[model samples]
Target: MGWLSMPLSSMHPHSTPKAYLDAQLTYERVIDEPAEAEGEGGPLPSRKGLRVIASSCLRNKVYYAAVAPTTDGVDGPVFAVVCLVRWNPRAKDGYVFAYKDMDETAGPNEAECPERILALLSPTENHSALQWRRRCIRNLARPTAKLEDGMRIRFASPIKFTDGYEGQEFFVRKRGRKTALAISEHGSARYRVTNMARMAFSVVPQTKVHRTVF
Candidate 1:
């Protein structure tokens, strides 16, 4: 039920608390400038945003850390730092969504939503790539109500981007086959990955962040 309960220090020696990891994930401009990111030894991975420190709890009442996350931040050129603290899958029903607000018809938080960096690539220049890329991140942000067999991520509803791309809905449904990340885009093809404990995702782009002043 805690971090020290696992085996990371003996191996990585940089195991910190979840709050520390959360702070790293949300980089700051003044305090964190553009210096070289921390190596894997630190609570945060050498590749900051690109990797997510996730943990899963089993019926045995022990928590196992997920391998470094492999995501492109959904391949976005620009994105904001957000946090996802997944509850134990084995927890009682109605607790999955953190689901207290599961029944609430709340809209997606734009500030927390991942962004697409279209330096010069516009709809006319290239729309297909931008559309698909957005979907990847949107899916990553969305949450799955219930955990099912062979399932990894499930975006509750399709996210619509109206700021730039029209009719752009980032939607995705991935399945986990044992230890492999069996993610299929529609039915075109499936990308399988082994070793769920530790993974490196490169599909999404690196994570760059900005500070918001309230």
Candidate 2:
């Protein structure tokens, strides 16, 4: 079965919005607990083993994201909070997920939604822009179709992320004629019209190395 087939309960250990957002702090404390309690000196624990948390959209203007610490300290994972559109009474329970290339222009040919606006705002290197665009176009495009009203749209890539360790998910809802995007985290509560054009973009490169010993 595919990853999406897994139940949300299974995919997310921290189901609540607050717990999900606090995943990073939880791991940090786990790393510091022994030292703070015993005043003993030891090597720091590896963070690479941590599990990434998933965020959920709530009925209100709130969202949650979560992740556990990795076993190796080389990498850390984090999730973001967002407010997405409420579930539609008229359709199935799932939400809409959208994507587009940062370099791609929002032309008349594109879907008539916030995604087009986002495409215009997204920076050239938005990490998941291309992947998201592909997913949205693939899933949303049809010869005789329209994005149903109240359908939720999730971004293929998480938003507002700096390092791989921390990222955000966007939840969008169409209510009547207006579409809104909400940031579901604890701090700095705010919502805006789903605008892909204003988001930041960056790319990370992978490298390989060789070592020799005598």
Candidate 3:
């Protein structure tokens, strides 16, 4: 099968904070400096390192946009902009790791904060969450994956996170015995649901097996 058709098993998901940081390092280098000289007319101020423009969560991913300096001697203070993106649970907040914060001398795991931030934004691997997310996406695309109360539907792995005060999981569930859909989180013996889409769950029972598929 082509890359698009390849199963998720074939995809090597990033598992560690270091790996994620490494993936971003090269791009970070390009954008961590001022675009132009002080005498030149650059739109942005001459910052020593990267500047975060936006850091927020969208769908199930964290999106970040920032500005960096360019190596090439382009006229009018050229700069290299960078975007740091990662898939995360829908419930978590997005975070930006500023390059200006890194200091080797006054460091005692200084990168730990950013690493924790990334971990918070990382998607859960819990089977239930993944299955629910997929079902919602499928419903949006094909309009047939809807589930109702008493329906036996398979739940996939959920996305889990522990960077915050407590660990959390994100999954999908039928809304109050109705056809409406909902995204939910499980923490401290309580389940809180968030309305991800307006479509209600179908009253029809699911014919598929309820086993953990993914």
Candidate 4:
């Protein structure tokens, strides 16, 4: 997590792959909403200055990385967007990536930025490299154990997410040789059970899952 000199404009829709723009926009809008008050710390601050520089969708969750200037409206060393309520806003389901350093920077004297997220802001790496890596891993992965309806699997672990899954274990609703569908009580999203590339996300009845994962 060193100096990332890439201009923020590089993340705009015209500059990013069309496949990613919509999800990034959605995440940006989600973070822009006023934070809900939960407890002692009260509500988190509004992030009007935070700019999402990269995003990728993996199964049911979408991950994003963002940056903000250290000082109010000026430039220089920046803070990374790491303290998000990691869940589907509409569903109110919670997924936790418990980082002790929720907000950190790359500059000296500041807490070190989380390297996994910081990689999304790397200048040497191609913008879409992480997305491509995830696609490849998802497509090639084979279940080491045969799956059956009602069997619970920690499938999210094999993908090597920077932050490991911190929610209920996924129970198989249905399974096939190549892909399967998982369900959690709090969230049920539309999914394409046959194909990974055509996965979709929409709030569905808790009993229905329209998408699948390999």
User: Largest TM-score belongs to which candidate?
Assistant: 4
What lDDT would each prediction earn against the true structure?
0.29, 0.35, 0.30, 0.35
lDDT for 90 in candidate 2 is: 24
Model 3, 1-214: lDDT tens digits are: 1111122222236433223333443232334445556666655533233332222222222222222333433222212121222332222333322122121222212111222223222244555434433443454454335433333222232323222222222234445553322333332222322222322332324356677877
Predicted structure 3, TM vs. truth: 0.24
**How does each model score on TM-score?**
0.17, 0.20, 0.24, 0.27
Question: How many residue pairs clash per model?
Answer: 11, 35, 18, 3
| Model 4 stretches with alpha carbons more than 4 Å out | 1-50, 56-64, 68-75, 86-101, 105-117, 120-151, 154-169, 173-178, 182-214
Judged by lDDT, which candidate is best? 4
What is the alpha-carbon lDDT for the whole of candidate 4?
A: 0.35
lDDT of 2 by residue, 25-76 (tens): 3453234334444556755643334443443333322333333344544434
Residue runs of model 1 more than 4 Å from their true location after superposition: 1-20, 29-129, 137-214
Per-residue error (Å), model 3, residue 3: 26
Query: Model 4 over residues 121-191: C-alpha lDDT tens digits?
Result: 43324334444434434534533344455544443223222234343345555544444445453344323
User: Rank by lDDT, descending?
Assistant: 4, 2, 3, 1
Model 3 has an lDDT value of: 0.30
TM-score of candidate 2 relative to the true fold: 0.20
TM-score, candidate 1, is 0.17
Clashes of 4: 3
